[model samples]
Target chain A: MQEVVNFIDLNLIMVGYLFIVGFTGGLVSGFIGSGGAFVLTPGMMSLGVPGTVAVASNMCHKFPKALVGAIKRYKYGQVDIKLGLVMAASASLGVQIGIKIQQIILEKWGQAGSNLYVSLSFVLILVTVGGYVFYDARKSARRTDTAGEMVSNLARRLQRIQLPPMIHFKTADVRISLWLTLPVGFATGMLAATIAVGGFIGVPGMIYVLGASSLIASATELVIAFVMGLGGSINWALHGMVDIRLTLIILAGSLLGVQLGAIGTTYVKEHMIKIVMGTIMLIVAFSRGFAIPQYLAQLKLIEVEENTIRILSAVSFGIMCLALAVGAVIILAAMWKGRFAAEEGAELPDKGSSLEVVSQES
Target chain B: MSGRSYARRKRPYGKVIGFGMLTAALYAAVYLNAPVVMTYFTKGGVYAVLPIATVFLFSYVHGTFAGSLWSLLGIDAKRTRLQERMEKRPAATRKISRPRPRLHA
Candidate 1:
């Protein structure tokens, strides 16, 4: 490995940009459990940080943020540690395989090919999964019984198989075969390795296949993220790819944002997480979709004007930033509304009671 | 009565300030000694421990500060009736293993 590090000179404007981006990304991660990387990586790259450094620094920051988020959710009785650990065990193995595949592709077809491969995978997975999640959230929203328990048809079917060595998740209120759980963890790891976004698959898989509710799935995904991020960070650090400066600066803002985001989750309903996750996914898919033409041009697979490619790249990054911003707004707004309503309910008197009657009753 | 109740909800000012100061000092140290720290941390070997350990330390310190900061600002999770109900429920029983049939003598 070449030891040449392309560390960017940090100016005031760059610092400010990174801090804001970090806070927004952290907020989203805190709320939904496993995003923020999809934004932070591109955000750093836009500021002239190399792709490897951005990824490594993001991974370095991720474990800590996930740790804090997981702990907070656990306090809320939203995390299933046993299930998270089981899934993480398989996910780590999947990450190793995913990395090996990427290395081979890099060796065979060079940088452009690797970039094209990553971009295509991002577009494909994000579209299919994001589209389904969005549709599910919409359907759930349309239901008259908003407070009713969510049941996944696929999860129900999976649970009926009665495969040997069934595991029960208490926090999630789920019982399913151990073998059935492995694929979700494995796919989460593979996707994390491929596009550096594991939660996209992990959260949905837990909800749809393992019969975990969206709330538990999102919270549990943070545990998987913590484990995966720690391992990935160590691997990247060993390769001398991590920029500690970037990691710390981002952490400074993200720490606060993540706490607020976690608190926000407590205020909102379960479906809100799905809505945020799906919205971010669809927007980011479009962002990556835009960047594909540029990668194709690099590989000489298609002829496109340089200016057009440049514009597309810029628009793609902007859209990515927009996704993070939109997610942050939704989380904060929901939290505020929920808090306000709770406060009002606490203060309001009963319909038949005046202030004097309420006071006497109290 | 409302004022009294509000006042009774004590803010974690001490924790916020203490952790905030400690976090600031750590950041200052890293920034002041950036060259030496960066060089040693990126040496690619047992040096890998440096970055990992540093992040964990920051998470503990800064994470606490952030949590306290929010509490002080009155941004907290509402204790809902549903959550209370869930908390009070008895733990679910785990399925026990059934005995296998014995082989014929």
Candidate 2:
């Protein structure tokens, strides 16, 4: 067995950094239904915490934050618990396979090569999916009366397939083959193991493939994240990798953020979820893109100076933070606008009543 | 909103304060005894449950506090009559129909 790494000493500045990131991460996660944890691992690592410990601590914080967020959204009548559980059931298996793949990569190419593979996967997946989601959101935004999510043509087609074991998801209002959910769940779990953000795939899959609304898809993602995070955290804890102090501090901020994020969801339009998720995914793709060059250098596939690699690493981490910050800003702005609109609607006299009075006067 | 009007809204201050205090106390205990907590938590066997248990405890306590704080601030889910109506609509139950066996085909 490998020797465990020592935990980093927490100064006031470090504590503050963790709390702020945790809050924003929680906020984004709550609003989008996928966690803000992708950044936390790197965020903790940047503060001199070991990578394993950072990941373990991040996982430890994730399940609890997700549990909180899921419950809040459930109250809003957005969550589909049955769908989440079904997806999670397959997703847990995907995580195991994903871990096996990672282990194989680590053994074959060592750490640098494994990192390059993860980064490349992040860049490819985030760009393709994020681009599509953002484009769809933009199209939806142009419509005057976008009250509910339109089921994707692909999902509708999939729903017609009557393979034995058709499951009905009531909140999502779709009945699709159980076989169809496996690939999505598996991919979500695999990605989660690889890049630590399965919700990227899970939420989008639920929305587009399974024909769930963005609201339900995102909310249900909390369930998948909670289940997966708990399973992963237990595994890491068994290895003595979780740093309780780090977990607790992050949890402190995330709990509040998650609830606030969940509240923001009820106030906003459905496309806004796609917009936030898409935008973050795109930005995070860039962040991961920046890291690829350094990993290439580490693997000696490209000749680069140590100083340049350091600078690139810093830029990558900065971009990652920017991705999270951008998501948080968009969510906050959308929430504020939604709240203002709601209040104004409340204050204004009924247009129907006014029209009736004018007709009577005439 | 006026304080009196705000009071009429009926925010759960008691739950907020109670959970907040408990969360704070729990945090203080963990941090103040950081060395001991770290040592036992990382023992890598049955001790693994400590971190899991601790986080679950915090989530329940602090999670409630956060939820209450938001409610107290009047930051809440949109309560449109339409949404209420939609929610009140009973959940659809799936009716699976089995094919009857034919005596002769």
Candidate 3:
């Protein structure tokens, strides 16, 4: 109890930091479906909060934020409740398996090894997946008249499979075999448990595999995040790890940011979602990459001075913050551009008076 | 535009202020009694419900306030074609497509 109390010594600066990060993180999450945790956990730890407490509090704040975001997006007709529920169920199961794997690694290689494993996975996954998404976004941006997200060939083939118990997701407008959804959901869960950000995999899976538009895929991810975060928070709370003070402060900023982000979606082009997501992922990968040397040094695989390791760690944290800031800037700028275009459209004659400037690309 | 959307576009400052006050009071109560709140909240076991339930309450009140505030500020979702399609999504009664059986020669 004393140790916990000592660890939670919050002040004005700490409160402001958490609130700002929370707002930016919430904005990105609302726009891209899942993010902020990759930065939030470490940000809290840097403030002297125990890692477990940071994670628990972050999880506590996440579900409600996601719930609010989900409802807001659902109003805009973006969320597919059925698909989200299905993915959530599978993801729950995958989380347990992912935790088991972590335990095994922890028992064998200890903390340094576990950290190394996580960093390597973060870099590899982010680079490969982020690169693909960014490339696709660029291709889509080049073509001005492409109306909505084009279904991928892989998704088309998967939909053709006549496996039993096909599910029709109304919002996503994709009829895919139930069997196909399981692996994607499972992988999403595993990644979430492993990396603390499952939407990284979940949104992309829904987009490239399930054939959902990026808009629907990102919106539906909030549902999955809500379900997963709720369950995870309960487990953490039961263990007495959640710091409600931290949770509430984050909620204060995130609630406003989330609603703003949700509305931003209705204003922006579809490809903008992919662009923001891919950019964040790639930057975050670079951020994680910077920390690899320290972990390697800890394992005695490389000799490094303490000062150099400290510098690397600080660099990594700065880069992660850069990722969040970049995402927030893009969303805000896009929203401003969209609003300006709408006002311009409103001034034109009745024939040109459209509520949405759908052709406006940034 | 949907009537509901049009109605939403008209700022409802009343609901926003009402929820905003309640949310502020709730946050004040929790923060003012931080010592007692922390001791009880971290007691573990069934007492875990306290934090969980508290968050749910905050989310509902605060979330509603935030939504209204955004609407008041004219940051509402636009009536895009995709959004319209979503709003008028076909009822469940719509025919479900089944895979056509194919026979290999």
lDDT of 2: 0.85
Q: Provide interface RMSD per model, one decimal.
A: 6.1, 6.1, 4.0
Per-prediction TM-score, please? 0.90, 0.91, 0.91
Q: Please compute DockQ, using alpha carbons, for every candidate against the native two-chain complex.
A: 0.29, 0.30, 0.32
**Candidate 1 lDDT, tens digit per residue, A1-362?**
54798787778887788788888888998888877888888788878999889999999999999999988877776788999999999999999999999999999989888888999998999999999999988776665142333568999999998989998887677889999999999999999999988899999999899988777788889999999999889999998888899999999889888888888876775677888999999999989999898878888889999999999988988898898899999999988876775565554221211122112222
Q: How much is the lDDT of residue A1 in candidate 1?
A: 57
Residues A1-362, candidate 2, lDDT per residue (tens digit)?
74668998999998999999999999999999875788899889888899989999999999999999998887776788899999999998898999899999999999998999999999999999999999998876664252335668999899999997999976666799999999999999999989999999999999889888777799999999999999989988988999999999899999989999988876676688899999999999998887888889888889988898888888988998999999999999988877776665543122211122122222
Backbone clash pairs for candidate 1 read none
lDDT of the candidates, in the order given:
0.84, 0.85, 0.87
lDDT of 2 at A95: 89
DockQ of 3: 0.32
- Tell me the deviation in Å of residue A118 in model 3: 0.7
Worst 10 residues of 2 chain A by lDDT: A348-357
Query: For model 3, how does the per-residue alpha-carbon lDDT over A1-362 read when each residue is reduced to its tens digit?
Result: 42344438679998999999999999999999999999889999999998999999999999999999999998887889999999999999999999999999899989998999899989999999888999998776664353445668999999999998999987677899999999999999999988899998999899899888788899999999999999999998887888999999999889988989998887777788889999999999999999999999989999999999999999999999999999999999987877666655543111111122222210
The CA root-mean-square deviation of candidate 2, after full C-alpha superposition on the true structure, stands at 7.6
The C-alpha stretches of model 1 lying farther than 4 A from their native spots are: A144-147, A346-362, B1-7, B81-105
Q: Give stretches of model 3 more than 4 Å off.
A: A1-7, A346-362, B1-8, B89-105
